[model samples]
Target: MREYIESQLARGRGYFTKEEALAELGLSAEAFQAAIGRVKRKGLLVSPRRGFYLILRPEDRQLGAPDPSRWIDPLMKHLGLDYRISLLRAAAFHGSSHQAAMIFQVIAPKQLPKIAVGRQRVDFLFQTSATFEEANNPAWLSKLKTEAGFAQIAGLELTLLDICRYFHKAAGINGAAQAVHDLGKNANPRILAKAASAYENSAVRRLGYFLERFGHNRQAESLKDFAKKAKSFKALDPAVKPLVAELGLLDEKNPDWMLIINVPVELEA
Candidate 1:
């Protein structure tokens, strides 16, 4: 059983389901259960989630965790989820590596339970919008080369917009502002605008505020136009509660864009 599992892993498969193991190991019903139990006891395999077991190399057993990126594809495939890696993880892939990502953030079509791998956390944020469907091309998802194969990650522009759309889940407005400032110059304004359209008006307002502050004038203006058409005012960062008191003197508003600033944002000189 161990040799067979290792052979499959050697062939570049990162993980397997119980059924796959049963057929490949050529074990009788009673024997298959025993084989799995033995391998698991030896730490040769790990079930990151139910019904999914990852093949562990000898070194991996010592470390006690496989690289989540390596096995993420198979796990998602087993669960039947079409997920796109996003946020700081996507930012790193796109060239903004200032902040190390603590969580492996993913956008899934439906709700998914959180997954823990060693010290790393795989968080699945659900998107209910039908219009915000994952794109099938390279324009939307950048390929991440893994031991298994390339994993699909959100594109640079999409990552920037997502950082704003989910600013609260991200590193608040201040951290997000820094990330936007870092990624702004390299990203295409039109692509950013297109991505922003998929989100709510509040997200548009947040994107416009940051883009404008960071010198992406054309992009900021486009997002501002969208914000003007929106019906409500939104805070630049939603996580900072007691909004007005938090900003104090820094609190201000862009009436035209319908955004209430509740935090101080300064771009790098």
Candidate 2:
């Protein structure tokens, strides 16, 4: 039985309930505790949460805590708010290495709402909106959300916007830039444009500027569209029109800000 548990731990599927362990080990609950204690003494598992045990190898957790998605799902369903992990949290899920990120950012689309778990680093954000922000992308739901009501995952542009809102924070700018760089290869024109559509959004404009410097063409164009959709830049942002004009990117048909936001990078097979 110990050998079998060790095998499952090798596969990176940690997190099992008491009953699960008992049945798997063919032991009573009391025996299960003894077994767990033995495993703990051997340094095979770590308790990321109470009653939850995960086998630990070098870089991955085995029998890790239940998927963050599983934990947040019932809660979100209870609140009836469609949410997803956004910003730094999403970037981390996608595997961009960064430092100093402690809270989980969640988005609902209408307004920014936040919750802080006591003494735990996990945090939550829910956008209070007339309509919950929705992600048609299935990948967003399954892999991006986390365990702590942290579910709202933002599109690339929205993430940039999300980051800008928190730019005043210490890790905000670096975290945001790292995210952009991580996705620098993935920001397709359409997704950027959609995310840029929320133009009353000041931080998004900053992201657009950053994209321009970094050569995100699609994102640049989306930024331009965001400006145009808002019906002019005089009061919204004085620099916007001038910047677009300097780029000579005005297209009555498709006035992208001319960012060329993505540059392709090869991934080896």
Candidate 3:
């Protein structure tokens, strides 16, 4: 059975499940478990999560893994869930690499338990399936090939809106602003306005201000146009405390965009 498993892996298969092995090779449950234990001890197999295993190359045995990007699609498929790699991770995929993300962030229709792959972590943020269906568009997602297969990540426009909506999880306004500045050129004006409108007024304002800062006037104007009907102001970073007390900055706010300027920002052309 060990030789059989090795033969299958030698054919270029990089991953497998106990059920697949059992079904294909007709191994009894006890035999399957024993076979798995043996390969694991030999450093040929690693279980990143229960019921799934990655076939490790001899070199990878030292690190005890392959890239987690290779496992994301298979794991999500195993769980039967919809997901989008998002936030700063998405920014990196779209070519605005900021600080390398220590944790891979995923937005799935249902909350998935956290997973650890080698030294890296995969964290899932939950959103209703309904919301995911509504916001998910082909234009808003990109398919990039990974070590094992492909992973779907958010596109630049949607990533900008998402980072602002989940501002606390992303780098603060400064970081978000820098990403916007770096990736702003890749954003499609019409698509950006539409995506921003789908988010709350606060998200719109934050994106609008950042777009303007980076000289994306057309996209910024479109977001501002949509924001005119809004009735309230949202702090630039919702996670931040009031600046007047917390940081001694004046209680200055941008009336046009209805964003509280808790921290001062300077931008140049």
Candidate 4:
């Protein structure tokens, strides 16, 4: 079992499945389990998901496993799920590093629980198949080079929309604003408009508001038609409680984007 593992590592393959191990070692189920247990006890192997094992090299042994970006592509492929690195992580990759993400974030077609391997944590967010498919267009996604090859990640425009769409998870509205502010300098109005068309109107409205607030008037203007078409008003920050109603304060609305300002947005300098 150890020799097989060594050969796999030599070939630069850092992960394997239980079935592959059984086939390669020609061991009975009980024997295979015992052998795996022994290696795990030595801190040479760790499994983030059942049946899938990550082989830890000497350097990685301290972390208990390789970085998630190095192996996430293969892991997601093994699990038969289509995904992309998204939200704050993707935003950071696109030069919006004002707020570092504490956990890796992924967007998939279905809901999934957070994964913890060694010192790493991965949070999964869900999008409907249609929405995910639309946003996963090659134009909107990019290949992020990693040690293990590459992982799929959202482009700058998609990252902005995703941050607005999942503000609660990305950080609060202010964090989202900071990210928008940071990325605004390089933003393309047409591409931003194109990407916003793929998401829900609520997120588009919020994104437009942020773009305009941050002085990206051309980008903000590009989204005005789409925002105007939405018949209903959405809150600027969906996660915030309706303080205006509670305190009997006048409801503040941004007429151009048709968004209710339920909370004050202060961007990080």
- Models 1 onward score TM values of 0.89, 0.50, 0.88, 0.94
Worst 10 residues of 2 by lDDT: 260-269
**Predicted candidate 4 versus true structure: per-residue lDDT over 1-269, tens digit per residue:** 78989998888788898888888889999999999999999888999888889999889877767878878898898899999998878887888768676569999999998898888788999999999888888887888887678999988888888998998888789888998898875778888887777798988888888889989888888889888798977777665546666776437878888888888788665
- Superposed by TM-score, candidate 4 places the C-alpha of residue 199 at a distance from the truth, in angstroms, of 1.2
Best by lDDT: 4
lDDT of 3 by residue, 83-172 (tens): 888887888787776735655788888867887656667778876777677667777788868655688888888888887777666776
Q: What is the C-alpha lDDT of each candidate?
A: 0.75, 0.50, 0.76, 0.85
Best by TM-score: 4
lDDT of 1 by residue, 190-233 (tens): 77766776777787678777878778787677676687687776
lDDT-based ranking: 4, 3, 1, 2
Backbone clash total for model 2 is 27
lDDT of 2 by residue, 100-185 (tens): 33455556544434432222233454443532333324432434433333344555545555665555431544555556655655
Better of 3 and 4 by lDDT: 4
Worst ten in a row by lDDT for model 3: 241-250
Show the colliding residue pairs in model 1: none
Which stretches of model 3 miss by more than 4 angstroms? 4-11, 242-250, 265-269
Those runs of model 4 whose alpha carbons end farther than 4 Å from true positions after fitting are none
Model 3, global lDDT: 0.76
